[model samples]
Target: TVLTPRVTLQVVLSRQYGSEGRFTFTSHTPGEHQICLHSNSTRMALFAGGKLRVHLDIQVGEHTNNYPEIAAKDKLTELQLRARQLLDQVEQIQKEQNYQRYREERFRMTSESTNQRVLWWSIAQTIILILTGIWQMRHLKSFFEAKKLV
Candidate 1:
């Protein structure tokens, strides 16, 4: 089965799939994706305790494209198609690398923001604690003074 973030592209349900499965999905969203599978939930399989194994071979970005098909489609000679494929692959690698860097930057920004919030929270808590302690001590002192015990 293949899925994009907003929709399910393909699903093979119930019927037995082989040990190996190949699927390609092009992601327009730069975030995370999920590839999920589960055993049949039918009464028979559940009662029998059936087990399943799935092997996935996933290729992303430009590697997902069949260069031979592209070449044939474009009617390019061997050398030109090979060069085109290499250039395309390199371009894809650069895109993936940039995506990783973007994620890291976003994570770093979030972490810094969280750290700032925590620091401010800690400061506020400490100030409240100190003020409460002072207020309590003053109240205690007044009570003792009125009773002439201090």
Candidate 2:
């Protein structure tokens, strides 16, 4: 289901049995997002009283699957479902690999730029040191000549 751009969600539920609930949220942006909902009951023992486990899986953009009902209505075979899953996995893997490459390229460019700046700064410092040394030597020579020591 395509949700509106921005909407508020209010969820209220009470657990009676050892049942579980799952909530899935998806957005348009690509990448992985996790939305979880769990029950916190301190009155009951850790292993006792009914434990409520809520597993939430959210897939965004093209990763979202909205054709399960349609596939079921059409009575798709097991092979069809397996093939669809494989294709989706392949596509997701390709997108992830491309994103990783983009990050690496950006990191490389930033490193090169920083290295260049450091090299220029070092060169400037060397030039300033040389100029200062020359000026000090000239000033010392003039002082000695005025005092007739050289």
Candidate 3:
């Protein structure tokens, strides 16, 4: 099972998928995805093996598509197949660009928030320093007068 970033659960294979299998899924949003595998092994089996071995090969974007299979299924000519490949590549490039834009927007927002906090902190620090200086000056003047030194 795969947990998409959007909180959607996609069950690739509910039953045993044999020795080798391939599953493809399209991501609607650009974010981290979680893959989970569960086995129905009994406690004794689990203790004996200590671990479950899984070989997963994940290919994202256009590489996941089988161009040869597509060409054969569609009975496409060489030129048509080339065109189809180009179109898929272009679509992947667009998705990549959109993801980059999303990251840039998030980074800009964080930078602005940090800048605002730093500006307010600096202002507060300056005010505290000014108030401390005034308090010390008044205290010194009072002490000198009481001692008859001024």
Candidate 4:
């Protein structure tokens, strides 16, 4: 089972297979994802001391595409296949750029929010200091006048 960054569960292999398996999935959203593997064996007592070993080979971006398969499936000539590869590369670059833009926008919004909060806090502190000074001066003036030391 694979859990996407959005927390959506996708079952790569519902049934138990051999020790080795290959699975692939396309991610529509850009974020961190989780992969989980567990044995669903009915006969747990068969091998109580047996250990399960998993080897994962994850590929992303341009490497994820099986170029030979694409070429054969599309019936593309050598030139056509090369052009298709270039196009795929360009498309991947565009997607990466869009993701970078999204991250930049989020960072900008966070920075602006923090700056606004700091500004407001400084203004509040200034106002409090001014009020305190005024109160102290008035109290001292009354004390001096009462003691005939004005």
List TM-score per model, in order.
Answer: 0.67, 0.57, 0.82, 0.75
Model 1 poorest 10 in a row by lDDT:
8-17
Candidate 2 runs further than 4 Å off? 1-63
Model 3 poorest 10 in a row by lDDT: 6-15
Per-residue lDDT of candidate 2, residues 1-150 (tens digit): 232323343222323433444444434443333333344566575467565545545455355765677479878887897787778888878887987998899799999999999999999999999999999999999999999999
* Worst-scoring 10-residue span by lDDT in model 2: 5-14
Model 3 regions more than 4 Å off = 6-22
Question: What overall lDDT, based on C-alpha atoms, would model 1 receive against the true structure?
Answer: 0.75
User: Residue-wise lDDT of candidate 3 within 25-51, one digit each (tens)?
Assistant: 666656887777776655686677686
Residue 32, model 2: lDDT of 34
| Candidate with better TM-score, 1 vs 2 | 1
Whose lDDT is higher: candidate 2's or candidate 4's? Answer: 4
Cα deviation in Å at residue 143, candidate 1?
3.9
Model 1 TM-score is 0.67
Clashes of each: 0, 0, 0, 0
Compared with the true structure, all predictions reach lDDT values of 0.75, 0.65, 0.82, 0.82
Clash-forming residue pairs, model 4 = none
